[model samples]
Target: MKSPQALGLALIAALALSACQDKAAAPEDIRPVRYIVAGGQAEIGGDSYAGEIRARNETQLAFRVAGKVAAKLVNNGERVKKGQPLARLDPSDYQLDLAAKQAQLAAAESDLAQQQLNLKRYRELLAKQFISQAQVDAQQNGVNAAQAKLKQARAALDASRNQTGYATLAADADGVVSQVQAEPGLVVAAGQPVAKLSQDGPREVAIQVPENALDAVRRAGGFRVTLWKGGAPLEGKLRELSADADPATRTYPARIALSGDSRSLQLGMTAAVALPARASGELKLPLTAILDLQGKHYVWTVDDKTLRVSRKPVEVASIDSDGASIASGARAGDKIVTAGVHLLREGQRVKLLGQ
Candidate 1:
């Protein structure tokens, strides 16, 4: 047998040899992705905004009278039509108040009748010389006062009945209930928001865009907005751009008007607005094709007919519905690497997938 020191050196040498073999087994070149250079007229030159699909009319539904919510008939996200009852409040208190008003009105009418009778008696006494004319006038004045009170009481009863109607919440316009704030048996104050309704109207794409994008949007150019839903893209027109940036976000809100079946679109749907009008000679590619190495965005470029691939840093101009519009650092005649970019390093050799 060998000495103890020699045996230890042999074991270390064997491990080193195995590591070298494993390294040799790995591929030297990274396979690059092939791209088709189809030179067609691209219509992506517009102010692309990153926005969401939002309802045009969003109204807050509320109760007119202060009462406990007795029954909430509609659930959140339910569709409601005009004049439809969405919620009911406890009307017991209002009912009792109306009844009291009715009783008061009745009492006022009875008093008016008694005053009329008294006035008639006074008139007869004055005519028979048993009472003075002034006494008759005073009784007639009392009758007049009672009549006025009865009229006022009647109006009060009518007003109380109107208040009772407030216990039932009605939808003033057609819309979808975006949010339900009132719950069954919850007491809410008058004019308090019970639900948020998104009215049925033209949809808009609201996006928070950077301040630099504001100038481009105001230049009055044809912009395109795309809604990605269920793998099918819905196109829209960039209708309005904000005049100023939001104070809190430091970004401008760009709105896009959606067309055709806006009813199917709901609020807060993720959307992409492509603003590639400012981009000149930039290639539009999928966001997945981008890579980040040391905080820099890169993409893999493949060599034709060879298994080797190269990594290149691309300047992303803007990202919208289609993908990222590359402004610089990539060209139409270039081959990009897509697979395994995160694991790739500079000067790494890769093989094309089908080569």
Candidate 2:
């Protein structure tokens, strides 16, 4: 019903409107990610490690002689002194036996005197040829037997005294009573833990490390300690490293002695042991550089003048307050993605954030 020119114009307008609607209907595309490139010149400080306080000398105090635990003078945590009587044993029997031994010793002494007098008489009689030589020899034998008996009695008395003395628990050194296993009237076996004496001294922080880290620790040179009580971070050295690995965990125990005893340092206080890692040679990137893809560790880096992320196998050397210290799998001048890496994949295009 319209003219040819009008129809042509309407057709062109409808085509243009259709093109506009098509463009509007299209979904919005995601924007490229931007990342910051950082240099690896920083010192990869020590990473945090869980640690505990331990006593270098934890002694288990025990009784030498087996007896009924008669008196418990001090309970756990009770202060004791050297040669201080912690408990007493039932000494009535030992005392009686000791007295009997003394009596026996006295009898032996009397018999020895009599034998000596008899020997003297025999010798004088033999000299005058009034008695046989065999008689004098018999008197001499009696004197020797009496002397042996006296020795035996003395030994028995000494043993009784030792057994009686062992009943009391004495402090070997000045320490706080950590534990008390024996109670009053409780029969305890010999050499059993009657008490635990915790020696007094400045406390230290201890930590357990994996065997793989032994070499890393040595190369790292020194370590730093950050007390969990929020005290000032202190520098310390690696005091010890167990040569043998723990069978249960296959980890080695590393003890770090704090430089100075801080007031907040308490026995059994938890701490974090961080070692300076960046100073030691390693690929150190920002914290955001680490990326995990399907159970594998990697980082996004620039390559070929394009932001292309690739799988980089990195051995975590240490974790510091600044960033992580990578043992390997990266080198200097590698541009690592600092943000938006979670949604990234191998060979994915990336634009530096805030660039």
Off by over 4 Å in 2: 1-43, 211-221, 240-254, 261-265, 278-280, 284-298, 302-335, 338-342, 345-355
In the range 10-46, model 2's lDDT, one tens digit per residue, is 9999999999999999974433665544444343445
Tell me the deviation in Å of residue 161 in model 1. Answer: 1.6
TM-score of 2: 0.73
TM-score of each: 0.60, 0.73
Task: List per-prediction Cα lDDT, in the order shown.
Answer: 0.75, 0.73
Among the numbered candidates, top lDDT falls to: 1
Model 1 shows how many backbone clashes? 17
Error of 2 at 141 (Å): 2.9
User: What is the Å distance of residue 98 in model 1 from its true position?
Assistant: 1.3
